[model samples]
Each structure stands twice: as C-alpha cells, then as structure tokens.
Target: MEKNSQAVFPNHQHSRGKAWRWTLWSVLLAAAVLIGVLQILVARAGPILKGRVVETLKTRFDSKVELDRLQVSILQGLNVTGGGLRIYPPDDVMAAGAKAPLISVDAFEFHAGLLGLVFKPMHVGAVHVRGLAIHIPPRKMRQQGAAKPRHLGKVKIEVDEIVCDDSQLVIGTDKPDKDPKLFELKHIVLRDVGPNAPWPYDAVLTNAVPKGDIHAAGSFGPWNTESPGDSSVMGDYRFDHADLNTIKGIGGILHSTGHFEGQLDRIAVQGTADVPDFSLDTANHPMYLKTEFSAVVDGTSGDTYLQPVQARLGESDFTCSGAVVNVKGKGHIIDLDVDVPAARIQDFLQLSVKTEPAVMSGVITTKTKLHIRPGPESVTQKLSLKGGFVLKRIHFTNPEVEDKVDMLSLRAEGNPKDAKPGAPDVHSLMTGQFEMSGGKLNFSNLNYTLPGASVALAGVYSLDGQQFEFTGKVRTQAKLSQMVASKWKSLLLKPVDPFFHKDGAGAVIPVKISGTKSAPKFGLNLGGKKPDQASR
Candidate 1:
C-alpha cells in the first residue's frame, strides 16, 4: 500500500508541472497577439494622423494643403516627422494673380505623449521646423470680408513651443510691376501656440532695403486666416549696423530702436535713429545726425509717411514731414517739406562745402521743399530744392572781403576818410529766393543791405565755391563824385553826377561781382560786359 501511494504522488507532481507549462504558453501567446495588434495600430496611425494634419492645416489657413511624407513612432511617446509641406492661398487670392504658396516647409517634427494623442485636445511638447517660407499677399488680394468663426472640432492641437532656425518672409504689393519686400529670418521662436490665441515670439531678421539686422520680441497673431496681412502685431525692435550705402546716393551707419503696433498692413511706429557718420557721397564729409520720428508704414508696399521728424545736424535743428514711396521700377522717392526756423549758416557750409572754415557766418531762416529721386547719380546730383532764405548779421570770414565791404559802407555814408584801414567789421543783411539743382544755386530778387547802401541782384553761385556772377544796381546816400578820394577826379566827375543819380538816391551805380568766393572782384558795370572786363 505504501509503494502505490508514493507512485501516485510522483504522477500528481508531474501533472502539476505539465499544467504550469501549459499556462505559461497561453500567457506568451496572448502577449504575442497583443503586440501584433499594437504594431498594426502604429503602422496605420501614420496615414490617419497624416490626414488629420492636412485637415487641420486646411481649416486653420483656409487654404489648400499638400504634404509629401509623414512618419509616426510610438516607442518613445508619440513622435511625428513630415517633409515637403505646402499651403496655398484661397482660390480667389490665387485668381487675383498670387502664384506663390502662402506657406511652405521642407521638414518638420513634433512629439506628444501617447495618452495626449487620444485626448480631445492634443498637447505637443515642442515642434521644430526647417526651411520655412511665408508669403503675405497684397492688401487688395486679401479677403476684406468679415472673418469666419473658427471651429477646431473635437481634435484640437496646442503646442508649447515651435522653433525655426531658417526662414523667410515676403510681402507683396498690389502693383504688378513692383518688387516684393523680403525679410530673411535667421532664427525665430513661438511660444504657447493655440488656435485663435496670440503667440509670443522672438525673432532675428535682416532687412533687405537698408540691409540691417533687427532683433524683435513681442506677441503676434490670433491669426487672421481670411486676411493674413490684417494680423495684429505689436513689438519692440532694435536695429543695428544698418548700412545706408545700399541707397545709391547716401552713406551712413544707422542704429535705431523703436516700438510698433497695429495690423501688418498698416503699422504705426515711433522711433529714434542715430547716424554717427552721416554723409552725402558728393560731399564726403561726415556729420553727426540724429532724429526722433513718428511714422505710418504700409508693410505690404513698403511705403512710409512721416508724420513729423525732428532732426539735429551738428548744432542746427530742423523739422520735416514727407513720404518715402516705393515706385514700380524706380526705387524710393523722398519728398519732404523742410523748415529751419533758425540755424547757423556755418553749420550748413560745414556739411556741404569741402573747404574748412566756412566763407561766411550768420543766422539764417529758411523754408524749402526737398526732393530726392533714386538713381545711380550722387546725392548732390539727385537732390533738388526750392526755397527762400533770410540771412541776418552776415560776416565774411575773409579779411579782404570784409575790408572791402567796410570801405564800401563808409563811402556810401559819405565818410570816405573813415574807411582808411583796420576799421570795425560791419554787418550786412541778405534775402533771396533760390532754386538749387545740378550742384548750383540760382538766386533771384536778391537784396543786400548795409548801413548806408542797398543793392538788388540776381546771380548764380556754384556749390564748389569756385565761381560767382552777379549784376545789379547799388544805391547809396553819397554822390558819385564823393565816392573818389582824388580831389581832381572827384571834381571832374561832379559834372556828370546828376546823370548817375536816380530812384531817390544821391547816386545809383551799376555793379558786378565775379570770380571765386576766396577772391571775389567788385567793379562798376559800364556796359553789358563781363564782370572781369568791368573790374578796375
């Protein structure tokens, strides 16, 4: 009986071991099946999620979408990778002649938790985009109608951050022939991206026109899907090392800081700019220039209207208002109304003239229209001015010129003996209407006044201070006979003094001024002869 019981126990143990093996096999089979199912789901998720991506972008942009490749992986959270994506503008916008896609990306990647993917609103930790390009349509092509309500449906997406290291933005104009404005972005970062919500952003970009680097940070969008150009934007920017030589006629190293707010199409900006070495190519003399300005800019067309600009050059102060407009084929045209209530003529001469120690000094007031046309010409050649100016307490720097003026005033006052030598400098007044072009100033109705004489003249003065030609009549209180120091000559000229006297003056004489500023010659105009010929 003992032997039989022992044998039964062994059989029972064997049966138990066999049962354990069978249970282990069943568990392994179930696990295999589950893994197969998961693999299949992951394989299919790529196409399904690809479709969702397309649908989301289409709804968000209100545009047609195209995608080249998509991949999905669930081993490490949920990873998605895509390439060759392009989003086109609305049909009507395309019909309006916009051929470029609204947005395009060469590659992109994002990651999310598997649980998050199944939730109502997907949460993505981060997204990285490469080779992105965004093109903004012209104002007329953008939808002017009321915006449509956004519906993200059951599956919405929220991203914590998005980064693009290389990107470009192009802004188009309504005119067919006009060139678009281009901005090259070196790096950009967007934070807390969600539907119909403003996204905070930081960016570094290069401006094409003035060729400068700009760093900006602010909030942009809550995007206007219907009219991207109408997207709201507010930011502060710092522009550095802007090379103004990109413009044909001017040269400067500019730095600016400003704040701007408004829709992309129309932005209001307040800023201050400093040019430590501002100069005209023709003059080649650098001057410190600074300005505080308020302006309105049309981003689409790159047109700016200056509400007002308060500027200082050296010690001189002025104000100007104008528009800088971009033409189709031609570059920008600058039209300004400039007013200088009080300025030093010496400051102007230092800026414009090549010679050191300006030829004259005085207080001047002027009102002028300044026009600059874009071309290959130098700034002096392209600049045109129409203005009127008044100069008070004028004093010539040259001793010879000052002495001559002093002598003339003494003689005119019938004090010829007082004009001997080393007399006190006399002040003068000058007023004129002037038009400047081709590096020359033409003066009309020019009036000059001193103690006892007044002269009216019309003439031209070259900018180089190389030539001066003037003809006019000088009226004085002294008789012509009294103008001579020689007693015999004075008596001989006394008989004909009545013939030279007129216009309520003791003597009226035709006078001419010619030669250079450094060596001006003053003479009597006996006939219509050249000033050189009339010089005594």
Candidate 2:
C-alpha cells in the first residue's frame, strides 16, 4: 500500500509544474501583442494629429494661419511641406489699407528633444525654413493723439540652426506715389540662435541691394515681441563687390565694396565706402572717378545728412558737406558747401565741355555755399550760387584774335631782348574776380593786357541765357596805335576814341560786345558825337 501512494504523488507534482510554465508563456505573448497593436494605432492616427496641430495654431495666433501638410514621426520631429502660409492683418488694419501680412514659405523642418520639450528649458536641435518671403510696408508716422501705451511681450524661441533658401523681401513705401523696392536673398544660413548661447549667432545671406553675398555676426537679445521697434540690435555686416547699378539716382557708379557696423534701429551711422571705378556721362564728356569716403550720417528727419564728406577726383581734392531737407513728397532742398583749393581749368573744361586742351589755361580756386531749390519745371532754374572764383595767370587762345593782334611781333619790336633791362614783355594773360549769384556773374574787376592794348571791364553776365553785356573801353599804347590796322582803327576807334580818351589812357575807344556766345556783334557807343564829326 505505501509504494502505490508515493507513485501517485510524484505524477501529481510533475503535472502542476507543467501547467504553471504554460501560464507564464501565455502572459508574455499577450503583452507583446498589446504593444504592437498600440504602435500601429498611433501610426494610423497621423493625419488626425496633423489636423489637431493646425487647429491649435489657429487658436493661438491672432492672424489667419493654415498648413498644407504636417508629417509626424517618432524618430523624426516634424516635416511640413506644401502650402504657402499667409497671415493677414487684423480687420481694422486691413481697412486702413496700409498694412499687409506677407510671409510665404515652401518647406520647413523642426526638431526637438522629447524630454527637454516638456520638462525644463526647451531645447530645439534645429529648424530649417526654406523658400520664404517677407513683405515690408513703407514707414509712416503714427498720429500723436492715436498712440497708445505699448506693452511688450516676452519671446521664448531657441534653435541650434535656422536655414532659409531662395527667399525674397519687398519693401514698400507709405507714400503711394513712391516706388517700392525689392530684394532677393538666396541660401541664408544661421547658427546658434538662442538664449544663453556660447557665442553670438552667425548668419550668411545673399543681398540684392548691391547684388552680393553678405556675412554677419551679432548678439541678439531679449526681444520684445509686441514692440520690436524699441528692441536693441547690433551687428557687423560685410558686402564685397556689389554692383551699384541697382541703386537709383546714382546709377553712374559702377561698383561698390563696403561694410556697415552699427545699430540698425537708430538714425545715426558711420561707415566707409570705396568706389573703385565710378563713371558719369555728361552732356559733353564722360568722367571717370575713384573715391574713398568716410562719413557720419544722421537720418533723424525725413531727409538724411552726410557731414564732412571728403573725396578725391582726378588731381583735385574735395571737402564738402551736403543736406537734403524739407522733403514732403517728391521734391526737396539741396544745400551744399563746395571748396576747391586749386584745380586746373584744362581739367575742368575736359570734364564739362568739348574744347581743345589749350583753349583755356589757369589755376582756379573756388569757394561757394549753394542752395538749390526746385523750380516749377526744373531743378536748377531757381539755383543760387553765392561764391567767389579766382583765376590766376589766365590765358585764352583764339587763332582769329592772334592774327589780328600780332602780340608776338609787337613784343619783339618793343622789347628787343637785345640789351633791354626790366623791359615789359608781351602780355597774354589776365586775372579775374567775380561774384556769382542767381545765375548771374558780376565781374567787378575784369582786366587783361596785351603787348600793345589793354582792357578793363565791369559787367554782368547771365548764365541762364548765355548773354553778355559789358560797358568797357579798350586802351591802345602809342606803339600799338601805330600798328593798329585801318579797318579796326577806322570802324571802331574813329567813332568813340575821342570821347573815351577823357577817362582813360592811350587812344581809348568805348566798345560793346553783344549777342549770343556763338555770334557776337561789336559796336562803339560814340556818346553824342555827330556822325560827320566822328567820320573825320
């Protein structure tokens, strides 16, 4: 009986151990299945999740927002594509028709750490924005009475890298009469843009202003989201070999290379500009220029000012300051101070007129304070130049005058360099001093002397119409009177020589030259002398 009982106990114990093993295997399999099912469900719900994200953005943002597609993944953060999102201004702003929301994009990517996103300070690995466009509206002064107390909002944005490709910016003016400007940027990349970064953010972008690549590095801080106008910004930007043809009003400048380092928010700035090859096409000739300039610009008002502008052109140096003021809509006032210590008339004429090299010769010095106000139809018609010009050792070459005067021959006869001490030489030069204002040149003293004749004149010349009217007398030395040909002596001097002799030396003749610069008529005043008496 004992042997039979022990055998049954062994069998029963073995059976119970087998059942427990089966139960443990079943539980493990069920848990594995549950996890797989949950993962499948999450994957299937991606579209629903994308919709929820769009709704959340619309609810949070004040402006209109839409997204075409949002792809979520456990391994990858978010891949947003297809759809240009536009944010329209508020109803009231739209009504004013001055503000517009103009941002569009082609693709974007966002990456964030899971634990960092929910726990402490959020840390984003990277964010890339591609094919973006931002439109800027023109500046307009806000109504003083309508200004409200501004409150700034805190900005909480961080990223390791932000990249933009194929972007554009449009800048418009508040005055609809003015033209808008456009800028195209390609391949913009930025790095380490976040709070408490180890170093300032570094950025690179292509600029359309001068059509060149731009590199920048700067520290950007605690940004005020609402009142960004008051935000402080500082940076250094460099642009190399930018074409100047894109700019207005100074399209003659071919190329420019420069750098700007300052606060962009203020009106005051300082920089250096170097124009390697600038060419200007004038009516008569073309001017080539190379300039090295430095200045402090203050643009607090509607117009800007460049004080103490220094430049070099050809063999001449210039130091001037200019201002544009009282700019309302289209026209403005131009005030300039020009001072040239010395310049060559030959050089000046080469740039201003089509003339022979030896036609005009002198060393000229000029000082002027000029104000040019726009006229009804012209910019310089109402110009006023208050200045003085000094010309030393002036000489004029006229083949016609040389033949009639024959100064060289007369000099040989009068000062036969054969043993004459301190003998006067043939005079072929003059000195002039004139006061210029209101397009009129008043020559208070105009004197020139030749070997046999001399002239002293006081007259006013009109620049607008190219008219010259003078009351002067020509004085001939005794030797010159003997050399004077019959035609001039009889036709001109014979009529007024006696009357003019009372006030001057030599055989003086009152002469007048009138008409256009191209065609001049010479006449004698005679001054009450009877025709028959003058003939004699």
Best-fitting candidate, measured by TM-score? 1
Error of model 2, residue 47, in angstroms: 10
- lDDT of each structure? 0.84, 0.51
Candidate 2 clashing pairs, residues 3+ apart or interchain: none
- Measured with C-alpha atoms, the lDDT of residue 165 in candidate 2 is 77
For candidate 2, lDDT tens digit of each residue in 1-536? 89999989999999999999999898888988976864764465355444543443343333356666655555554333334555443333344453556456677766554343333334556667777776543334211113334332233334567677777655454554443444466666556754333235555667654566766556553432222222344456565677655543123333334433322223343445555444222212445555444443222233446566665655666666777553445455778887878877555555533333434566777777868674443332455666666665555454443333344335323322221332333335455566665546667677666665666666665543355566566676533324344556545545554544554454565665555333434566556332223333
Highest-scoring model, lDDT: 1
Candidate 1 residue lDDT tens string, 1-536:
99999889999999999999999999999999979977986988788778778877876776689999999998887899998999998777888777889999999999888776467467787889999999988878775334556554443666789899789988888876567766698889999876679999999987876888899999989887778888898999999999989866678899999999998888899999999988765456788999999999888877889999999988899999999888777787889999999988887877776656777999999999999887777778888899999999999888888898888998898888788667788889999999988877878778999988999888877777776888888999899888878799889999999987897898988889998766788888778554344434
lDDT score of model 2? 0.51
TM-score of each: 0.86, 0.58
> Candidate 1 clash total?
0
lDDT of 1 at 369: 95
